[model samples]
Target: MSDTLTIALAQINPVVGDVAGNIRLIRDARARAAAAGADLVVFGELCVCGYPPEDLVLKGAFLESCEAAVHDLAEETAEGPAMLVGAPWRVAGKLHNAALLLDHGRVAATRLKHNLPNYGVFDEARVFVAGPAPGPVAFRGIRLGVMVCEDMWYPDVAETLGESGAEILVVLNGSPFEMDKPNLRLEHARARIAETGLPLVYVNQVGGQDELVFDGSSFVLDGQGRPAAGVAPWTDAVEITRWSREPDGWCCEGALAAPVSRLENVYRALVTGLRDYVVKNGFPGVVLGLSGGIDSALCAAIAVDALGPDKVWCVMMPSPYTSADSLEDAALVAGMLGTRLDTISIEPAMAVFGSMLAPVFAGREADITEENLQSRARGLTLMGISNKFGPMVLSTGNKSEMSCGYATLYGDMCGGYAVLKDVYKTTVFALSSWRNHTRPPGCLGPGGAVMPERVIAKPPSAELKPNQTDQDSLPPYDVLDAILDCLIEGEMSVPETCAHGFDEDMVRRVWRMLDRAEYKRRQAPPGVKVSSRAFGRERRYPITNAFTRLI
Candidate 1:
């Protein structure tokens, strides 16, 4: 029987459906683990073909490729440390999310995921069938309880493994990042440790996958539910932990990363999501309209931080209603970030459109149609630059603007990706202030304030018309965000929302707006999913419906 063991937790970023690239990542991690003298290397769920492969796992050829890659990886384990990796496997004519143990140039054992998640950002039940409750896999004289991502969430699996004589619990996860998710993960892990009286190890994937961003806050918990070791969030890491069999149970020893602040984590999520989406999709750089407003300014800062200032191109498209303060702020922001700034006036386009449409409306007064034309002109200007320079246009609409349909359809919403799509306006102000005071690790932007303080302090405006503030069309951001949280995140009814000290009439109005804007949200670009109930796959609502009235 072995008295000592070394397990290397490999936190890696894998692209979905890229079998060869994923294999290379796995092999590189294995080589590093072997050099560190590890007995086993543990990787996240679906490391072979990436996590949440969506419907890609349904393809027979993709599954065959992943299976072949696993075999090839197993052959490499003959002379080095064994590996425990996750991949989709076809067993008995049914596909399962299986964790395979590779040793001695062969596949030793496999454990299928028992609980398939079907809520929030996950739909694993649609693609993978649930396996029977797993016991433990024997490795180097230690019976290790192996549970896939969702399996650790329930008690039945852990209890079964503990009763079956499992020594340690290892969980392979691809859990996406939401606010307060790290603490929630720890709570669940501690619960399992309490039930089993066995130490647990968690390994999670890190990277941007479509709207989802996986924060790899992998950690280890002792038998007494105390933190033994951990890796930081928002980055890929390979941490080696030492374990020795003590009299009571197995103990772990390693360094613990400092806890990250909520604001810092949210900012990092935005940067990481934007970086991977632009880089993984093979875009040279990003071009965004840098309005003087808080939303566009924050989007510019995030883009500059994600891709270096050199790769970020900012343009200021001023209209007749554009304030001089906005022009000055935009220029100062560009200078501070060291990004190229260009000026393009949309006055000519507005004039041309007005003249072209004069025949249809001989005596019609100016209204929202004219305001929308200004936004569309600016959108066209940005898209034209994008086409000429091969850069993706970034939209700068936040959740608050998107929620009440306060944004123009093709105007501000014209972008390949929306960096602040899921972020509320109030949170945008908070993040801007936080970034100014502190610069997080792995950022390419300047250390000091990226924008003038007045930018955040000023009232937000679209600048479509004169002396117009966001409040002219919508409620105050603080109130609007709170009401939105209740309706969207809490899924509270009108009366329930009003119970939170909100006026009944206002709550009903907000609810109506929220329901009416579903179609606009349907056409919006995908952004990072940081909230619990993001608007995409996580929260789906039918556009044409009478459910709102009934509620």
Candidate 2:
């Protein structure tokens, strides 16, 4: 029997449906763990086939492929650290999210996930049958308990593992990132530890898959539910945590050291999502209209940081209403970021559009329709460039504007990806300031002043009409963002939102806009999700519903 156990947590990112590539990742991690002289290496949930594989897991051939990949990884365990990997297994004509403990070139034991999460971007129950609670696996003379991602969220799995003589709990997670989710993960793990009196090792998948970005802040907790060590979020690395048998039980041997967590968890999440979405989809770069407003400026910084200046192309599509200050600010930001900027005047298109629409709209006052024409022209021009070139168009509308339908559907909403789709206008300013002051490691952009100071200080506007400010159509951003946080994240009712010291009529108006904008949000492209209740998958609402909380 080994006196000490060294387990390596490989917090790896796996591409969805990339069976061979995922296998390569598992093998590579195994080699690293072996080199570290670790006894076992644990990977994230669904590391073999990726998480929330949507409908791909249903296909017999895909499941067979995943099954084959698991066996293949098992075969490589003869002279290396034993592997604990996640994959979909076919059991008695039912598919379950299972974890395989491979040791000595063979499958040692298996545990299926007890809790199959079915809400908020998870449809595991649709494809996988519910797995029952399983006991721990015997490994190197010690009983090791294992559970898949959602199973750790509840008490049944951990409690069952502990009662069955498990010395330690190893949790595999496909947990995606939302604002402050790392803290929440620790809180949940601590609760489980308290219930079972067993120390826990939580390992999570990293990288962006579609709109979901899994920020890997994997950690280990002592039996007293205290955090022993933590891996920094939004990073990929293999960490070794040693445990030794004590008279009371197994205890962590030495302190685990992780990188210091910064204030940019959400910002790093956005950057990761944008980078993966572009890279996985095989897009060479991204293109966005830089309006010199806070929203666009923040998006520009994120883009450059995510994909570097060479890959991000900035364009200023100015109209007759475009301010000189805005143009200067846009140029300043482009210069600071070292991104190529081109000026394409929409003045000619607006003049032609006005002439063409004038005869048919002779009796009507020049209203929002004229303003919309300029926005649509810019959208068209951006789309044309996207088609001619290969870069995806990154739409810059923030959560506040989208929540109230302040953005036009075919106009400002035209893009392949919505960069700030989940970001509120208020958070945008904070993130931009953070980027200018601090450059986190692995960012492709420069450290100081990725966003120009003037860009952050200026008032935000669309420049679609003369003397236009966002507040003209909606409430002040601070107020509007507060209302949105209540209605969306808090899921508060209209009266409840009003109780937050908001004006009743304003709350009613904002509610109506949010309800009406459902159709636009449905049409918008997938963006990085950082907030708890982002518009797309996290919060789903019927576009045609007549039921409104506002009365």
Candidate 3:
């Protein structure tokens, strides 16, 4: 076996369903690797049609398009180095998540994924059939084993490949971020290397698609399960590593850099997710409703930082109940950020709706139905602007409102993307404070106090009715977010949430609302998921369930 082989991994972003565009990306990346004198280039999982094509894979024409794109990619390999790229291949009338080995202007071999993850945000079992035995392909005078995304999660894939005369293992991944998931990936990879006694390279996709964000923390581990080379998170890079075969198998010879902070990594993931959602979808810019509330304020900061002031338009839709402080605070914050600000009073539309629904009210006492109408009217005005202009409307509701049915269905929830839908209310406040103290890398605003002090200090409210606060219907946000953390993220039973010094009644109340709100969450726009158990795709609850939490 030869000792000196150079491998290149291209951690690049690919938009879903953009076959021609993705092929161009692959061609460009492979050209760069060939220019650097590398033997072969590897890309992340599902590079042809992009990661988690979701239901797009179900379409026969789309899969055919992906296949056509892969063939075009295989021909390009003749001009450069061999390419190990991930895509979908149908064999025996079943679709498999596969990686193709391209050399000498053709596909030399295909490696299919074995483990299909069905938990959390993954539903691979529903889409792809599990692969069979592992095999090694001869590329550049070396036998290399290729494993797709979830295949790397299991030890059997690496062990079988290593035992079958494979010299190196390369795994392509479209793994989504979930808090400390990168650390978990490293730990799992080390264990697999220790068991297989083979050097391994892991490459992952970067950027946000819908509710999922892929953190590109691609790294190489030596035969002894030691770190070799790595690329940073939430950014695109092409990393080339030189390896040598030893008595023990293969080892890496290079100086490894320090790892970035967890805070920094997560913050970058949010930014990347935001940037991709806006750019890839072909929106001219983004428009957000700027309530002085923490959720809207945080989303405005993220939008301005992601797309800059010229692209972000902030509107203050004040109602009769709108506080002078909230209106002033919102305008003040928008001024600091330098984004285009517009105020559209909803009172006129409110009168129209009020008059229209007067017969139905029938002299009854006004309730939350009237309050929700106010929210829905505001939503319609924003949509009207979005229809006339090309800017995408960005909704500001957080995970807490999304989880407990606190948000109106077509009201505050209407938008192209829910910027903070995956972020908890508590986290919204924390990130807001963090942004005020120290801005992120590309924040487009004044130095001090992007959000007003009064905004953060005041008690939260919908302000639909006179003197109505959020606590009237729910607990304190501090208490409410914590209980939700336990119930939703922690997956705690009703009793388990109460164990955390919470009142049992409050815990039960939060849990009940969370259970009943499943339908609303299903209809929400995609948001950047920052936690393990964001309300959509991950934690599923039946909308029709009748079980009640006992007090």
Error of 1 at 305 (Å): 0.9
lDDT of 3 by residue, 99-129 (tens): 9988888988988899989998898999999
Clashing pairs in 3: none
**What's model 3's TM-score?**
0.94
RMSD of 2: 1.4
TM-score of each: 0.99, 0.98, 0.94
TM-score for predicted model 2 compared with the true structure: 0.98
Candidate 1 segments whose C-alpha is farther than 4 A from its true place: none
Report the C-alpha lDDT of model 1 over 326-414, residue by residue, as the tens digit: 99999999998999999999999998999999999788999999999999999999999999999999999999988999888898889
lDDT by residue for model 2 (1-551), tens: 66799999898889999999999888888788888888999999989998769899879999999998888778888866899999999888888899899988988898888998888888888989988898999998988889898888888888898888998999989999987777788888988989989999999989999889998888889999887767767888888888888877778754455544444787888899999999988999999998878888888888999999999999999987899999998899999999989999999999999899889999899889988888899999999999999899999998999999888878889998988999888888888888889897789998898877878877788877788888888899999999989999998999899999999999988988999889989998889888888888778999888888526
lDDT of each: 0.93, 0.87, 0.83
In model 2, which regions exceed 4 Å deviation? 254-262
**Overall local distance difference test of candidate 2:** 0.87
